[model samples]
Target: MRALFCYFSATGNTKKCIDLYQNYLSLSGVESDIHNIDDGKLEFNPEDYDMVFFAYPIHGFNAPENVLKFAKTLKKCKEKKRLIILKTSGEHLRINNISSYSLIRILKRRNYYLTNEYHYIMPYDIIFRHTDLMAYNMYEALKGLVPLDVKDILDNKIVKLKYMPFGHLLQIFMLIEHPGAKINGLFMHTNKNCISCGLCEKACPTKNIEIDEKGKVHFKHSCLMCTRCAFYCPKDAIVFGLFNSWKVNGKYSFQMPKEEEVDKHKRYCKNSYNRYFKIAEERIKNQK
Candidate 1:
């Protein structure tokens, strides 16, 4: 069966998992193609492929807006038998709520059966300045949870048992709602090292950072705090308190590519920053 694996990865953590899945799929002899959703538009007849796997990061406990748009567009097309969604979030999977459930219902109406849903943890966003080493450890722990026979489970009617649900619930409540929860402190002040290149704004998955009319960097409340922008920054101006100094020890070791290299990675289809800017501008105009 032909399978298409489409994913949206901002910090490369999701990409690492995708790569692992691709390798495993190749070993299983399944014909598959993997593409970053940001590289180009996904225009395909759903009838041609037996399965569609969506891998993306969770934003504010929901799928990124672009992924949601893509899912809606797919539902408008021909029917498909199996649809699987895998989300990578710093948060646990059990908190998968009404928003995610609603998306599944939309797909069901369009004739795609919900096969399975999986969630994995990743490093917290540095932008939010809340780095949880425990979350990173949990992400690493998930490597052991990968099923030996993903293909066998694909067409199975049962939602396979995976993850610790109670653990996930506890995590969600403690991390998001608990008053005593420690903040990540990701958005520290910009230093003289900043070049005003606007790379941070473009690299951010949430479109949280933007250049105001005064040409200063501004952040919105919608940010997921993913550190892709800061970690990917050339000048190293963005910091997360002491993390900056800690990261500096590994300086020249991380090998962050040049701005051109970053621009070429194609994580978002077209530059989402521009689209978000236009939307923000329209909202401000309407408010006035």
Candidate 2:
């Protein structure tokens, strides 16, 4: 079967999950093409592929505004097409399950039916960095689960989140992040650490970061709040405005460090994080 992956990955977590899916799906004899949603326009039609995967990182309990806009960009399908959602979040909160509420509603109107949905827990880019150990664990767990999820999709299984009352309404309420993100982007500025390398300008998904002719970095209102400009900044120069204190800079190694005792943020989301890892472990073991 052929598949199309239309994904928005900021900070690489979602893209990393997509990479795992692509590798496993290829092993299962499926050919796939990818379209990074940030790369301008959608050139592929959903009807051309057997199945389409909509993947993104959950932002503020909902899909980012760009994802919603991308959904609108799709041409209405002539036939009932299958679409699967693959989302990644730093925390494993059920509220995040509602992230797809708006996206699915738009796609459904276009005649694309939701077949399966999968969630992956990945390292955080904002609100505080996860411990290296936690990052390693989260990445490893998702790696272990990707194959099983691919197999389920290949088998034509239907997997979806449990029914949540007022899911759509709750997601609508969370839409405040759409504007909040823009305002926050305006607040983003560079400090003395900025060396005018212009990396942030080139990496911003929304083209929100612009380096003026005078070497001044300016942030525009189009920011999707993906935090890619700040998180992946080589010099850690981009201050994330009001959320600067919570900004997590640097890419995760996703490697098990030899001395692994760094658990400074262990109490941040202890119970929920532990429960997610434990459940993921059980599920992986069962799948084996």
Candidate 3:
């Protein structure tokens, strides 16, 4: 079987999950190709593959803007193609499940049916950074869970979420961030700490960031608010406008660090995060 992975990853967590999925699927005898949705380019036809995986990060309780736009551009498939959704979020809130509502609606109209939907918890790109230990654990959980999920797909297991009432309304409401992000992008400014290395400009998926000849970074109104500019900033220079306080910088090493070497977060989202990890652990063990 052949598969296509189309994804939008801001801080790389969702992309990491895609890599894991692709590797595991290959082990199951499936060949796959990848499309980065942020590029606004579709290199392969969905009909050419047996299945298409839509992978992305949950942004503002919804799929990022580029993903939705890309879905609309897909040609209407004559044969119903299977589309699998894999979303990554910082925490495991039920509300996060609604992120796929808009993307799924657009795809279904183009004749792509939802086959399976899976959610994984990754480190935060915004709000607050997860400790290295937590990030490591999340990565490990992702590694363990993806193989099992890939096996289920190979076996034709119809794993999908039940329909939710008023899901459309909720998804529409969450889309406020769509326009809000563009406006918010205008407010992003660099502080003295910025080295004018032009890193943010090159990293911006939307090309919303630019560095002038005089070494000043400017943010455009086209921002998708994926936080790529801020998260990957070498000096943590980009401030997130109104949400500057919530900005999380630096890449996740996903490496095992000694527990004593890392500082622990003070039980923030304690119950929810704990429950998520616990459930993931159980799933991994039971599958074993």
The digit string of per-residue lDDT tens for model 2 on 1-288 reads 899999999989999999999999999999999999999898886788999999999999999999999999898899999999999999887888899999999999999899999988998989988877888999989988999899899999999987679988999999999999888887889999998998889998888878989999999889888889888888999889878898989999988877857677778778888998898899899988
- Candidate achieving the largest TM-score: 2
For model 1, residues 34-86, the per-residue Cα lDDT tens digits are 76765556765666778777778766555555565566766444655677777
The CA lDDT of each predicted structure is 0.55, 0.90, 0.89
Clashing residue pairs for model 3: none
Return whichever of 2 and 3 wins on TM-score. Answer: 2
Estimate the overall C-alpha local distance difference test score of candidate 1. 0.55
The window of 10 residues in a row where model 3 has the poorest summed lDDT is: 258-267
* TM-score for candidate 3, residues paired by index: 0.96
Error of 1 at 8 (Å): 1.4
Candidate 3 C-alpha lDDT tens digits along 37-80: 86777989888998999999999989988889888889999999
Candidate 1 vs candidate 3: the TM-score winner is 3
What local lDDT score does residue 234 receive in model 3, on the 0 to 100 scale?
A: 90
Q: For each candidate, what TM-score against the reference? A: 0.60, 0.97, 0.96
